[model samples]
Target: MGRFITVEPGINIFVEDINPAGRKTIFFIHGWPLNHNQFEYQYDVLPAMGYRCVSMDWRGYGNSDKPITGYGFDRLADDLRIVVGALQLKDFTLAGHSTGGAIAIRYMARHQGFGVNKLVLIDAAAPSSVDKQTANEFITATLNDRPNMLHNLTNMFFFQLITGPFANWFMQMGLQAAGYATAAIMATLRDENVYSELQKIVVPTLIVHGVHDKIVPFAKGQETSKLIKGSQLVPFQYSGHGPFWEERERFNQLLIQFVG
Candidate 1:
């Protein structure tokens, strides 16, 4: 149910296509330092709920071509355009997590949500500026010690205390992400401002965030809800950065209700 779709001359995007014949499609964009596999859970659940689930790693992450350039949000948005065109996707609901969330916003702002009918953001890192002190510190830490920063980030994003096979699973996925993408993409992301785009989104939008999200604080979610005219915000009150994984059943139930 998955294959690589060529985005351009040399770029091939690896897409996980579930329920190939489902009437509606949901193109998923994963976060930084991770591939489309982050939505592995959704792949299993969404299709069964009568929706086609499609996800791809950004150009430089996962099994996609790791080109030397095109790591910025603008390029990321372009990549989505290429994928949708290649796949002939329509009336699709765009869902993005973390960095992917910001990319989805850019896709709307830059392209004006052409074929997309709805939007979903899961603990997105948006409305951030590169000039912010917090972002600058993160950039510094990522530059100075990438591995250490990733390790700390994993713990913070998942939960304060990670244990068992779940912890191992999460760590391995994070490790497999391209270091180049992780390092280079972060700076490009920090330079963007999605609040205006949020305000412009007229399609039904769902903003999902973990109340305990440390990477993209809960306040960011609240602000995003406020900015997006009719956007709805759902908080995973007892989870961290990844509510899809942390609260699978609840998240899926809510997502199904929203997308259906």
Candidate 2:
């Protein structure tokens, strides 16, 4: 169900392809510093419901080869395009979370939404969501002390009370990534503006955001929805940055409803 795919000559991306026989397909992209493992909760349920869930650990994260370069949105989005072509994925629902959502925005514009029928943005960081100053501070923390930075990240990740062990597990995923890749992604979040990219999304789009999200505030979600014409915005009342985990059941239901 999982394998390493050669996205380029030397770069291989880890892909978790499940339930290949399912009627519908969902291609997932994880957020900053996380991997496909972040979608564990969704993967547990979606496949059983006749959904073919596919996720990849983009370069420098998870089981993927961590090259120092190609961390920018252009290269990242190109990697996605290559993967889609390699997988022969067509008419699939493209879903992205946080920074992944920003990359997804770039993909829509850069590749003309290639092979994508529907789009889903989960607590996406986009359209100038975070200012330059905060990004610089976060980059400083990531470079100087990644462990503590990830620890603090976990604290902001959820509104629900997660067990200590669960938090540790989440932090471990971030640790698996390369330090440069992690910091480079934050720099992308800082320097890149995806407002024009958002306007280019022409597919049926869904925006799911946590009302209490401190990382990428609820207002960004609201603003994102407005930018994408005809996009639907749904708020998770009891979630933080990670609505998919904090209010998982509701999140799963919303995904099912939206994808349907």
Candidate 3:
């Protein structure tokens, strides 16, 4: 856990910066209904390997301020911009997972990735309607019972191991997110189209997808790779939605290699 810095008046963003001032910085944007903890494995391992890891719990998730609104990509990208400027980071890898992937894409497209060196997408939610499980299911489950939905989704799709401790920990992370924010984000993802903007990003990009990812299909990763010029796609054959957790060592090493 690191300090909570106020990026806006009443909106403080929680950031965990590991091995500060290390060789290079990697700013990690976590998945939907999740936060900095989603990259706990990466933050712990990469820093010791001489690469600084910066993970932020988006404004309504984890230890950050949970307001009633501001769940779209425009605000999320600005939040990331402010966080990067606050840390005075430059030439850093901007990585995102799932919904965070969509946010990263928008950031590059809209903000033109001012301080970013490269891009990484992990089990990313696609621009169009590539989510196989469908947003309707998520909306229904969230509206019905968001907490229980996380438990069920975690056990059924999130991980390959599906052990008691791992699933339980993931569920806890998902539950901590603000319900209003989660609901609003889902709706935005459901209606918004990021496909048209992918061509706008010209930075060196990497797409990492678990082959068994049920939530966001591996084909979507392929599609995204096709859309971006000179982008590379890596696969974790044995993992699920979370390769950083399911295949921690390989994921970290691949990231290091990509940035190096």
Q: Which lDDT value does model 2 have at 16?
A: 93
For candidate 3, write residues 144-193 as lDDT tens digits. 89988888788656546667887778888888888877777888788775
Models ranked on TM-score: 2, 3, 1
- Tens digits of per-residue lDDT, candidate 1, 1-260, equal 76888877888878778887997888889987788888878887888878899888888788787777788888889989888887888889999998899999999988889789999999988766334676666667777886677667677887545575766676666666566666678778666667677777889999999999878889899998888888899989878999988898899888888888
Count clashing residue pairs per candidate.
Answer: 0, 0, 0
Instruction: Give TM per candidate.
Output: 0.92, 0.98, 0.95
Which structure among the candidates has the greatest lDDT?
2
Scored by lDDT, model 2 comes in at 0.92
Residues 45-71, candidate 2, lDDT per residue (tens digit)? 999999999999989999999998898
- Looking at candidate 2, the ten consecutive residues that score lowest on lDDT are 126-135
Provide the lowest-lDDT 10-residue window in model 1.
129-138
Off by over 4 Å in 3: 129-133
* Model 3 whole-model lDDT (C-alpha atoms): 0.85
- The alpha-carbon RMSD values of the candidates against the true structure, listed in the order shown, are 1.9, 0.9, 1.7
For model 3, name the residue pairs that clash: none
Q: What is the TM-score (0 to 1) of candidate 1? A: 0.92
Q: Pick out the ten consecutive residues of candidate 3 with the lowest summed lDDT.
A: 127-136
In candidate 1, stretches whose alpha carbon ends up further than 4 angstroms from where it belongs are: 129-145
lDDT of each: 0.82, 0.92, 0.85
